[model samples]
Target: MDESVRFDPKSPLFVNDPHGMLSILRERHPVLWGGEARALSGRVFSVWHLFSYADVGAALKDARLMREIRHVLTDEELGRAVPIPEEFQTLVNSQRNMMLFRDPPDHTRLRTLVNKAFTPRMVERLASHIQDIATDLLEPWPAGQRFDLVQEFAFPLPVIVIAELLGVPKADRDRIKSWSRIFTQVLDVEVSLETLVRGNQMTKDFRDYFRDLIAERRRNPQQDLISNLIQVTDDDGGQLSLEELLDMGILLLVAGHETTRNLIANAAWIMCRMPGLADALRRQPDLVPGAIEEVLRLEPPVMLTSRFLAEDLSIQGTAMKRGDEVSLWLAAANRDPAVFAEPDAFRPDRSPNRHLAFGQGIHYCLGAPLARQEGAIALKTLLTRYPRLTLAEADLTWTASTTFRSLTALEVETSAAPQ
Candidate 1:
């Protein structure tokens, strides 16, 4: 296990079966510090990866670890050596403005402006529509045959839900999937130059499309999140600028689509192996929500999130310097035995589940409630539509990413007539 600590995040060993390796790392080296400079996009920085639940949870709440270092560190003080690629500037700038990448006042301001759109009441209003979309997608499937669940249902269900929520046309949802995928991929600790360049171009394309939509919403306000975002303001009359608005739209698309898609696929995959679980869910539909939580705990969508130190600090008697990057492994923490009983076991009704799937503190995912609701609805729909299911193959492959834990494709067979 000690020798396996050097394993790369994108390697086949980690992607396919990371839990077994992660459990060992958590037990042995919870605070595994890299003893060298790590380069991301040609820029170098020291990094420390936190694997234990205690360390990850505490670090997430610590204000000293800031999301946007620019808020405190000046360009001269930081002394950046490599300039960002010309093409990647749009993507970088958009990320910088997004609430996901901001700290304190900016993050608070941006999250506050859109908080109303994600409240329980708001998400509940869309429940019927989500179910309808799921039903519509499943209606065309051929019974007693093998098909790709991700391609047929899991992928498109959330896209349609979020698209309508954002007031975008259903026809246009297909175009933004690649843009969102590229955005999540480039968020890794190290990404290819080509990936960055491609992501930047897609960023520009989506920005252009969103620009027209924003303008149209301003012209004719509608009953949708986009119109609300354009017109609504905080208590202090704070409104999002054109750049901020565009970035917010991009962030919503990425957050809403990717996580929910994986959540549904992962839940279905787990159920296929659990004997009589499908009948249990159908008999007791209320178990679907609890089952979803168990899935989130066992396999989170976002693996790890990074924060930079605002000032020099020490943790667990380990000396750390200012500006050092800390990667909090949420996937590792969610599976830590110190917190969960039989952390690896798939117990659908596991109570008091305190999984940090959506993270914690100021940077907690804003779309969490919506994502959970979408997951529950999607799973229930899948269970109703397909009474019998089995994995298309035994060996499964995940996407090539360290940031996202997603299936490359989930092929499921429901070789029974649709219920």
Candidate 2:
């Protein structure tokens, strides 16, 4: 570890400029171990932070690095962790059932079922509707007016799209969007007890809400993703459990839109910051796809992910004990010069870009297709409508989280009236 370098994910400076903060440490080490990392359950474990692209990429695919640690940890180790507050138990239970935290059979089961409902054709079909929603969000152009693009545009678009896709009704869109925001707290490395209690209540409310919805779908199936998922069964004729169904709903509702919202907002922020980038894309719309890829490479939605060592492993000659956690800095790896030429410089046209923004292996984001499409459409529509947009605020704020790289608000001001 470099004693001179400090890379605290929660610090304001790190949140504001993660790439700038990670550059030196990444150049110095492929793997940095010998520190304690805190888990959501209030347990502390020995941690290793993987910095280089090759190591992070391989570690993601390594079978020995497990996503869920409870299965491998001894009873004593599990008991040593702080117990969940009684009120927070329900949320924790539902969260545990999510595929994001599962391994092997459970992860395979959930992802397979959801994939049946989330087909490529389904995402492809939403293109026109996504464009329409984006167009309506910017109605009347708001030209010459200052608006928070995040609140007004970027955030709502994905939530509305994902909600509608999940069979949520038109009237419930606003409520679900608010719930989505609160649910993202689960991704934060350090969450306060107050937040946890409030989330407990929110959890109960949404569980009951989904319970009713799932029951209705059972009675009369609809054309939505939830209804489709309910019908999926294994070869032995087993279907998702009621608890599994509810948690899956919550996971999709939260993970579906939140990250994509960041993708769109980050891309917009980048374009505005880079003069003529938006105009160039507007002139040559074919570049939009590559531009989105570049944005994903440059400013990925989820920055870092961690895994527990299922067995003893040696990464770069450093021994990592079984049950220890390693934090893979996907954001840092994306900037690895060994893989990318001039890694920091944005090149929309850069070919053979192999960035792990959406992650890799079995846990690769299921919603990557939809996210890329949504980002492409949303940015294409926005820049097409307003070619001269620029950041309105002198300074921008980001959410304080290690897992999420989302903006608090993206204020934008148009320089002149649209032609």
For every model shown, the clashing-pair count is 0, 0
Highest lDDT among the candidates is held by which one?
2
After superposition, which runs of candidate 2 have C-alpha atoms over 4 Å from their true positions?
1-5, 38-44, 80-83, 416-419
- lDDT per residue for candidate 2 within 1-419, as digits (tens), equals 44454457778888988887677768876677636866656567787889889999999998888888877687677656677779799878888889999999889988888887789998998899999999999995556777888898889999999998989999999989888888898667678887877787788889999999999999999988889889987766778899999999999889887899899999989988986788789889999999999999889899989899988889888877888988999999999999999998888899999999988998999988999999999989878777578888879999888888899999888766433
Candidate lDDT (C-alpha), each: 0.84, 0.86
Candidate 1 worst ten-residue window by lDDT: 35-44
18-101: candidate 1 lDDT, tens digit per residue? 888888878888877754564433445667878889999999999999988776466766666557669798888888888989
Model 2 weakest 10-residue run by lDDT: 1-10
Question: Once model 2 is optimally superposed onto the true structure by TM-score, how far is the C-alpha of residue 305 displaced, in angstroms?
Answer: 0.8
